[model samples]
Target: MKFLLVFTLVSFIISFLSDRNKTFAGTKKGLKMFLGLLPTILNVLILVSVFLYLVPKETLIKILGHNSGWLGITIAAILGSISLIPMFITYPLAAILLKSGVSYRVLSVFITTLLMVGIITLPLETKYFGIRASILRNILSFIGALIIGLVIGIFL
Candidate 1:
């Protein structure tokens, strides 16, 4: 929030000192983009809330908690792939899970997949990037994430 505030203030100052007309036009464009994304944002929020509500904490812990081992990592990857979580929320949730006894290995896999693999966004990706490229990218990301998690687990 502080960064955003600082950025906005700087932008405003730059605009005020330079071309007010262009600034207004840019701001209008930005607002329109935000408004267009509002529905998707709301849908994500609802999906996240319902997901958390439907999946019991105990079950989550049991499957992804310590002693779950490699199977836990696999499960975490799968869950992360399917869920469309925003990155801003993903890190804190991972931290909370870690505090709640989830192993680092599992969290590593979860975070990797959360950032890299996007099964839910595949259609949009394919639409823009073509189906072949999208599939290849996703497949590579999934494999790369697993490798990264395994490497991190080994090191830490």
Candidate 2:
């Protein structure tokens, strides 16, 4: 993380030096985008926190543990589809789940669907991409996530 921060800072400095006006403009645009998404981000964080608090570890284990089999995969897929957590948070959470004995198959499906399929963001996606395209993309992504999970389960 420190390396990434230093690298990003150095890269930004170089870019700023190369073109101050463009750098400032880009930074401003990025900040604006961040601000625009801040509300949704905050909502997701709160929802995830509440969910974690309400759903005990034992319940999670029962649902997604190694012995859960295909039912767990289906549950994971549904949860991932509906969830709105960011990728950074997803990875750490995945690691925690793995440590807690969640099956690799379920985790793979959850992470894949969480990243690829966005039921919670369907409205926003439809607004930008049209309903047909959004729905088709999500369906394909869901199928792909399942296939990927199956393959991962086989290997791991």
Who wins the TM-score comparison?
A: 2
Q: Give Cα distance to truth, residue 142, candidate 2, Å.
A: 0.7
Candidate 2: tens digits of C-alpha lDDT, residues 1-156: 799899989989999999999999999998998788777767766876687678887887788887788899999999998988777467766876787668899999998899899898899999999999999999999999999987998888
Q: What lDDT does candidate 1 reach at residue 132?
A: 99
The pairs that clash in candidate 1 are none
**Poorest stretch of ten by lDDT in candidate 2:** 88-97
Summing lDDT over every window of 10 consecutive residues in candidate 1, give the lowest-scoring window: 87-96
Model 1, residue 79: C-alpha shift (Å): 0.7
In model 2, how large is the Cα lDDT of residue 114? 90
The per-model lDDT (C-alpha) reads 0.82, 0.86
* lDDT digits (tens) for residues 13-42 of candidate 1: 899679988888888998998788777767
After the best TM-score superposition of candidate 1, give how far the Cα of residue 59 lies from its true spot, in angstroms: 7.2
The number of the candidate with the highest lDDT is 2
Q: What TM-score do all the candidates reach, one by one?
A: 0.62, 0.63
